[model samples]
Target: MPDQDTSDIADIEADIHAHLAEIAEIDAVAVRVYQLRVAHPTDLVAQLAERAGLQVAEVARAERHLARLGLLQPSPGGGWVAVNPESAAESLLAPVEQDILERRITMAATREQLHALSGDYLEARGMRSAKGSIEIVKDLGNIRSVIDDLARTCASSIEVLSPGGGQNEEAMRAALPLDLDVLGRGVRLRMLLQHSARGHRATAQYVETIVAAGAEVRCTGVLPSRMLIYDRHCAVLPVDPEHTGVGVALIRDTSVMGFLGRLFAHYWRTAEDFLADPECDEAAPPEEVGGELRGIERDVLLLMAAGKTNEAIALQLGISRRSVSRLVGRLMDRLGATNRFQAGARAARLGWLASVPPA
Candidate 1:
C-alpha cells in the first residue's frame, strides 16, 4: 500500500512537469526542476538533479531561470521551493503595472503644463504680426480702425504725439467722443500737440473739453513724428511724416519701443502745458507783447496780408465762416481800420504780424 501511494505521487509530479513544460516560452529543464522542488521542498541541487535525471550544473541553470520567473524561492529548511504560479505572476507583473500607471500620470501632468504654455504663446502671436513684430497698416481709415481697436483694449495708458499744427473741426468731432469714452474708463490719456494748436478755436475747445474729462495735454514747437502709443508696449507711426494721410507703421519691437518711449519722455518733459499761456511765439523767438491782439488775431492779420479772404481764413483756421466774419469786424474796430487792407497794414505797424505762425 505504501509503494502504491508513492507511485501515485510520482505520477502526479510527472503530470505537473508535463503541464509546465507545455507552457510557451518557458525552458523545459526549468519546468522539470520546479516540479521536483515542489514535490521535495527541502531537496538540495544535487539530490534534485539526481531525481530529475540531470547534472548539478543543469539543475543550477534551471533553478536560476525559474528564480528569475518568480517560480522558485529559498526554503526555510535550506533548499529551494516552488512558488504558486498565480502568486508568481502577480509578483512579476505588479511593479510593471505600477510603472505604467506612474507613466500615465506623468503624461497627463505634462499635457496640462503644455496646454497652459500654448495659450500664452498663441496670445502673444495674435498680438504681433505674421511677418514679424512690425506691420504696415496702409490707408488712413484702416489706421484709425486699428487705433480704435487698440484704444478699446488699452489697460493702462494711451499717448499721442500729434505733429500737425491743429486738428480741423471734422477731426475734432470724430476724436472727442472716443477720447471721452477712454477717459470714462479711467484710462490715462495724454496728448502732445504742436504749440500752434492752442491758438485754433476749434482745437482749443476740444482740448478744454478733454482736459475737463481728465486728460493730460502738452504742447511743443516741434515733434519728431506723428505717433500713438498704447500702454508703452505698442506704437503706431506715420509712414510719411510730411503727409500723414499715406499710411502708418505698427511697431512691436521691444528695443524700438523702449527707444521711442524714451524719446517721448524727453519731449514731454520739455513741453509746456496746453492750457498755459504761450512762452514764445510758435513761429519766432520770445519777445514782449505790445498789444492785446491774441495769437488767433495775429493769424487772421497774416492771412489777410497775404490776400486770403474770410472764407479762406475760416477754412485754414478750422473755425466757422460766421466766426471769421465776426472776428474780422472786431479786429477792424480794434485797429480803427475801415477795411481788410487797413486791418493788415495796421496789424503790421503794431508789430502783431511779425511772429504770426504760417496758416
Candidate 2:
C-alpha cells in the first residue's frame, strides 16, 4: 500500500541509520554539522576542521558521508546545504532499531543450535587424561619445549630437584627465561639443591635470585635424579644423565606422578632451608655429628671429616680462612689433639664424623 516515492526514501533512510550506528561520536559530529550548516550555511572544510580541531581532510570525509545520506547536498554557489533532520530520522532511525533487534534474536537461536554438538566434542578431546597426554620428547630442543609448555600451562605449583643447584653459565642462561616466567606467574615453587651448592660462587648467586622471587629453596646431600613435577599431573625425567641433550621422558602416568610427589614430600620434610644458619651441615644430621659439640663446631668437624682444606672449609661454611684456623685450634684443644690430622682422628673416635660420607 505504500507509495513508490515513499518506499525509495525509506530505503535511503535505513542505509543512513546503519552507517551512523557504527560510531556514536562520528554520528554526533555529523548531526551537529548538519545543524550548523542549516544555521550558517558555510561551505569551507577548513572552518569545520578548525571548529572540530581536526584536519581538513577529516572534515571532508565526514562531509562526503553526510552528503550521501541526504543530510547534505551541494549548493548552487559553493559548499553544502543541510537537509531536514526530522523527516530523515523518521524514515531511517526507527526501521534500523527494529533491524538490530531481529538480528540479535536470530544470532541467539544460531548459537543454541550449535550447542547441540558439544557432547561430541567432549567425547573427542575434552577430558584432562585425553590420550596422547603421555608424550616422549626426544632431543634437547623438544625437551626444552615441553618444559616451557608445562611452565606456561602451569596454574598452581612446581617441584624441582637440582642435585648440583645450577649448571654452567650457558645452561643457566638457557633456562633463565623460563624460570623467570614461572616465578613471575606466582606459581608456588619448591626446589631442592645440594648442600654443597653454596660452595659454587655462581650457584650461590643464582639461588639468591630465585629465593628473592618467593620460591622455597632447600638443601640436601642426596637426590636420586634430576626431576621436575608439574601440578602433580606430569613428571619430566632425563633419558641420560651425562649428556642432557640426548632427550627426556615426560610422564603423565598418574600413579608414577603420585609416587614422585610422595618422594618429593619425604625429602622436603627433612631438607633444611637454604637460608638456614651457615654453621649447620644440612647434608648430615645433628645426631650423627655427635651430641657433644656446638652447632658451629659440629659444622667444622663435619667439613674436617670430609678432608676439606681450611680455605675450602671457610668458603663452604661461610667464614674467613683465619676464623676457620682459630675454630680448628679450639676444636683440637677441646679434643686434646695437637694438630689438624689428630683432631680429625679424635673427632672420628668421638663419633662426630659419623655423618660424613666415607672416603
Candidate 3:
C-alpha cells in the first residue's frame, strides 16, 4: 500500500510538470530543472544539475529562462528561487486586465457623450420626431444658413439638382465657398444642372472651378424640382417650385428622403457630364445657331406639330418647360411664323416634318 501511494504521487507530479511546461512554453530541460529547484529550493545551480542529470550550464540557462517568465525570482540568500505559479500569473496579468478595464470605461464614456450630443443636435434642428422632421424656413438667409450647416455636417455624399437653366453669377459666387468646404472634407458632391447652363459663360466657369475641386457635375434638360439630398438621410427642397426664394423645406423623414433620393438617381443616370467637351458651346457648328435645327430642336418641332403644350413637350422629350419654350421660340423665328399653329403649318409645308410619320 505504501509503494502504490508513492507511485500515484509520482504520476500526479509528472502530469503537473507536463501541464505547466506546455502552458508556459518551457522546454523539457527547463521543466526538469524547474521541478528540481522547486523540490530543493536551497540547491545551487551545480547541485540542481547533478540531481536533474544535466550539466551545470544547462541548469543555469533554464534558471535564466524561468526568471524571464516570472516562474523564478532572485532569492534573499543570493541565487534564484522557484516562485508559486499562481502568484507569478497574478503579477504578470494584473496590469493587462486593468488596461482592458480602463479601455472599456473610456469607450462607454465616449459613446454616452456622443449620444447626448446627437440628441441635442436633433432637438435643435427640429428633427427629433416624425412630425417635426420637416422644417419650413421662409427667410432666404435662414435657408442658406441651414443648407450651409447641412453641408458641413454631411459625412458622405451630397446630391444637388438646380433647374431653371444656368445659375446666375451672383448665386455661383455665393456658393463657391460652401462647395470648396464640402469637397475638402472628402465628401462626394454631385450637382445636376439644366442642359442650357452649358451656354452660360458664368455657369461654365463655375462648373470648371467645382469640377477641378473634385465635384461631379452633370447636365440634363429635365429635372422635377430643385432639391438637395445629403448623405441619403436628409433632403432640402424648395417650398415653392416655381419661385425658390419664397421658402424652403428641410425634410428628414426617411420615406420622403428615400423617394427624393431615387428621383435624383433616376435623373442622374440619364444626365450627361458637363465637361464632356473642353470647348463646350464654342465647338458647335456655326449653322447650329443660324436657323439650322439642332437634334433637340427638331424633336421639339415634331412634338409641337402633334399639338403638344410646352409642359407636354417637356414631358415627352424629358426636358424642362423652359427648354421647350426656348426651342419653340427659335422654331418660330426660323419659320417666320407668328403663332404655334402657323409654325406647324409652315414646318410641314417646308418639309421640316417629313421624317415624322403620320398619326
* Model 3's TM-score against the true structure: 0.45
Q: How would you encode candidate 1's per-residue C-alpha lDDT over 1-359 as one tens digit per residue? A: 45765665466435423333333335567767878898988788899999999999999988887777678887777767888764675565455445445645765676667756744664676686653476667877898899888888888898889876768688679778889999999999989887568767888899999999999998765566888998998999876677787778777878889998888886676566788754332332124234645445555665655456678777665555676677676677777665443455566557665553343
Compose the digit string of candidate 2's lDDT tens values, residues 1-359.
23754665477545533444432233545655655677778748788777766788866777787776556779998998877643443343445546545655765576567656644653553355643344546876777788889988998899988775445776666666777788899889888876667566777777678888888888765566788998888888875555567777677766778888998886676566776655532343433444455344566666664446677767665566776777676676676654444465567567665443321
Estimated TM-score for each candidate = 0.43, 0.45, 0.45
lDDT (C-alpha) at residue 258 in model 3: 77
Error of 2 at 131 (Å): 6.2
Positional deviation of residue 182's Cα in model 1 after best superposition, in angstroms: 1.1
lDDT of 1 at 111: 62
User: Is 2 or 3 the stronger prediction by lDDT?
Assistant: 3
lDDT of 1 at 42: 77
Native-to-model Cα distance after best TM-score fit, residue 105 in candidate 2, in Å = 76
**What are the RMSD figures for all models against the true structure?**
41.2, 32.3, 33.9
- In order, the Cα lDDT scores of the candidates are 0.70, 0.65, 0.71
Candidate 2 residues lying further than 4 Å off, grouped into runs, are: 1-134, 280-359
Regions of model 3 farther than 4 Å from truth: 1-132, 278-359
In TM-score terms, candidate 2 sits at 0.45
Residue 125 deviation, candidate 3, in Å? 14
